[model samples]
Target: MAAGGRASGRPAKKKGPNKGTGGQKRRSLEGKGATPPAHMRHWFKDKSRSERIAREDRGGTTGAGGRAPARRRSEDAPEYIGGRNPVLEALSAGVPATALYVAQRIDNDDRVRDAIKVATERGVALLEVTRDKLDRLTEGAVHQGVALQIPAYEYAHPDELIDLAHDAGEPPLIVALDGVTDPRNLGAIARSATAFGAHGLLIPSRRSAGVTGGAWKTSAGTLANLRVARAANLTAALREYREAGLFVVGLDGEGTTEIADVQLFTEPLVIVVGSEGRGLSRLVREHCDVVARIPMQAAAESLNAGVAAGVTLYEVARHRRR
Candidate 1:
């Protein structure tokens, strides 16, 4: 009767239809195998990458058109030589070098080797470095493998220079450069100073060339053998020299007296030469006790700085010798 439900206290089992969907199962399987969209791939490709990583991993472009910068080598760099004949000449002449650098490879060249040998003999430090090392030291200067560090030149007090002359047991014979900016001119003047037995060289600190390697080379290493003094104000220095019983003579084209006519040997004197382009500064000309001109052939308007100094020095020396 009612399927004998619970009449005998027994559990009854009922059966119903299953509600499973094949389409739902197929949809879930499709979601599991889904692929990334093309736009997503494009976005990932557009992301920024590390430069170093690109260079190492992907071979990216370098800054200089995909090329590395050129490297500089050392042998072309400048080196300094001190205490050698040239260095000593520059110092004694007051040429104003601060430090000297010598290359180790200098021993390979005869001239440089000899220069090093002498520098070592005089207790100067000779640094040895590769050509690349020297290039780094000079920072791309055309140092010719030799260079000298020079201080901002300072002038000895005019009084001190005069005193030095007196102490040397000789009359003060000083050569003053008015506006010579060429180191070669300075070197030549230094040579003349040494050869003529002058006391020292006087140069204006500003607008004047300090002793340099070019000057030293031009002096044929004679700058090391002379004394040089720099002046803050050349006119004032000249005035001081005058007060010290030294005649300040300016060499110019328009001079009242001839250099030959002046009696340079008997009195203490300071000879001044102007620049090659500009003869002399106005102030320097005014400070001179005498302005004398060197006699030259009409063919040449002026003499080279070195030649003119030599001539003047020779005349002074001749007069002294007489």
Candidate 2:
């Protein structure tokens, strides 16, 4: 009985050459096809030096090389704008975009063909790249399989905006944005300007969003339909509007009168909406003929920049209709 107990379990299978533990065997198996640990895999991936520097900016690991890719100061990189409507609108607006990038395998629908024709007519370059390349260029943005490379947006001068309005017919309704940095907000305002029959959009050259691919997309092609004027100084532009015999109304939450309460259609008007977080710059506020607020529920502190501009535009249109 004692011998049986001591020599139990068929001689313990001879210990198998003391081959470490189960973990070692599992690791060996994993080595065959297992994904590298996250840290190690990141190290082996190819990335540009600028991308590595950007990663460092975000406080991410840059791997063992720690060497960033050389930065090219040239302006050769294409400006990418995603979404169908924005790109279509830009094409329609005759904005000087540099090229159009379509996925090689994208469906050649009628709309897509029309877009291609428009781009070709405008002398914009058309390039077909793999879907992966497109995705990378758009930085995983929702491109809908099409993207456009446009030159940096060229904004018409403030005087040009006024002249455009006058050329269309005097007493123009001009829409201006103050310190709104988001391209989407800018685009939305552009759309509203067109819908409300405004002649042009005036944006300050500094501290304001410029027309870009994202803005063009948000405008749903409205950017192409409306004139955009860039100003050296917003306050100066407002002053120009005043000098041009156009009434300038600034939208602010603290205004004593509501937008609806004010008469906006009797004369040529320029409606200005401020930034999302900050309303208007002090100088911009000082330049307004009247600062009006949109009536809202007490629960609402403020409206989205785009929404506020649209509402003000609607009121102007309503008065014009009357």
Candidate 3:
């Protein structure tokens, strides 16, 4: 046997599987750590749920360890109640709010303080976001350093409007908007409806204004007391009301009957106000039991949708009172 050579009894020792080389080859078989695709590297891929949730709570992380904000809650997506008075009044009126977002280092006026107090009392989540976030949420409107996250308004069914009147032991008196698109107009109509004893409001689900925060503020807190319903088809809804024994009265400048003289106003009535520019739609006019005009001083003049509805409601209320 040569010096420093493996000893063997009978045969020269074979190169015993090249121990060092074999180990190196085995290691080489395992490739280097490669980065995963961006989508595949989501935190949810982690087997441990707690770790995944922690990462998610921390706004999640990209493959490169970059952070991304979590998805917005459905309740906080749109429908912001901006302005100090709007936020405070919405809070005071018990409007369903998902969260109250106050700008960091706000002016801390009475309205802000009251809003915070009310939110705290109601257990509403209070989020402190940047002023820029508030501005974006309010869409460049004057937010007044505070904004409330309002969920979609829960609208009542058309039948519920009548039920409201029945509950009050009064004839069903509803104010239906044919195509009014202004939130402020809707708000003012709501105010007038509530004040003049109209039971509820009926707004078309599409191509019409809804009860937004602006409308809520314009209603002067009357929206809290009033039930506003959404109708998928305004003309069809009028027909349904007619079938239910309630008279449908549409407001237009060219109608044959004057609002004050329309006998239907005294009955279970649904006064339909048209759009600000076009007045009543042709199909809606066809559905009315009586298409009545708001008596005006000049033939050329036209009243605003809100004003016409208010004036017509006043006439109905007057007749009901007498």
Candidate 4:
């Protein structure tokens, strides 16, 4: 056999251009197929001229409701608290978190250990995630190998607050916040409400602070024991409270009655606190049964919304004790 020949000793055939059957023609007889619609076609030039000129602007359209995804994350989204101490403190204070995330192979320190133990005892979800995933979950915060997910707060109706007090066989002393936008102030007021044995909280549905993670943390877990109600209209809710035989008291610096001198403690009450910037709105003041003030040494002196709430709650509790 030749050097590179096949086993049969035949020389290799050289490649050449293909030539088909010399007789019958088959596929050449077929006609051209119909073209698709311009809109359905994928090619740019094949598309309809109108479509090419006026392309759909997908920028402004968000899915069904058309609400921006950022709105979902704004006030109603579940919140995460990162860092070992924050997570541990939240757990220790009975913050009712949904999940406790521990980074994979995290350092087992006292806070992390206690957090895991307490979470386990409280029936909280203990999830193990990678450190990179934990970083994303915590949004680039200093996680320290731990993070806690807190659910969005659920609100109750204002009537439910009254009913809760009724079930407890006590006069309803609910705290109602007006124009207080600070979540921390809301939290501190909640803490004071819990401390002074108030029934629940009533806040305007809009232009007020709803419960948030900061409020939960500032409340020191006291929020769990308190119910919060939202009102579409503060004046309307106050009118309803009046109809239900609850005295509506507005705390204003320029009010006629002083907190110490006011004499309606034993009655069912809804104490309305205004914003730190503006004490009370005109309509809220008009709706209040009695507009009372906290006596300050100097008339110009003012207290924070939280301090004022605490002081007012304390005074109410003291007077009720008499």
Best by TM-score: 3
Estimated TM-score for each candidate? 0.64, 0.71, 0.74, 0.73
What is each predicted model's overall lDDT from 0 to 1? 0.69, 0.78, 0.84, 0.84
TM-score of 3: 0.74
Native RMSD of candidate 3 (Å): 7.9
Model 4 CA deviation exceeding 4 Å by range? 1-76, 83-86, 103-108, 128-145, 298-301
Winner on TM-score between 1 and 2 is 2
lDDT of 4 by residue, 52-102 (tens): 335432223245686533323455678777878768878888886999999
lDDT of 1 by residue, 1-322 (tens): 3563456555566655344644445564455456687566665555534444465443344566667444422323333433345544443444444445665555345545564555455555556666555555444445555545554333355567777877988888989998899987997888888898888888877888866555665676566556678888888888888877888878887788888898655679888988775687899899988888888767666777778888888889888887
Q: What is candidate 3's lDDT per residue for 1-322, written digit by digit as tens?
A: 5566746565764565555555546675676789776568666456567776787655564554554755443522457778899888888888778899999998898889999999999999999999989987876788889988877778899999888888889999999998899999999999899889999999988888888767876776678789999988988888999999999888888889987678776789888899876889989998988988877676665789889988888888888898
| Candidate 2 collision pairs | 49-68, 49-69, 86-217, 89-221, 93-224
Model 4, CA-based lDDT = 0.84
Candidate 1: 10-residue stretch with minimal lDDT: 72-81
- The alpha-carbon lDDT assigned to residue 177 of candidate 3 equals 92
* Candidate order, TM-score descending: 3, 4, 2, 1
lDDT minimum window of 10 residues, candidate 4: 52-61
lDDT of 3: 0.84
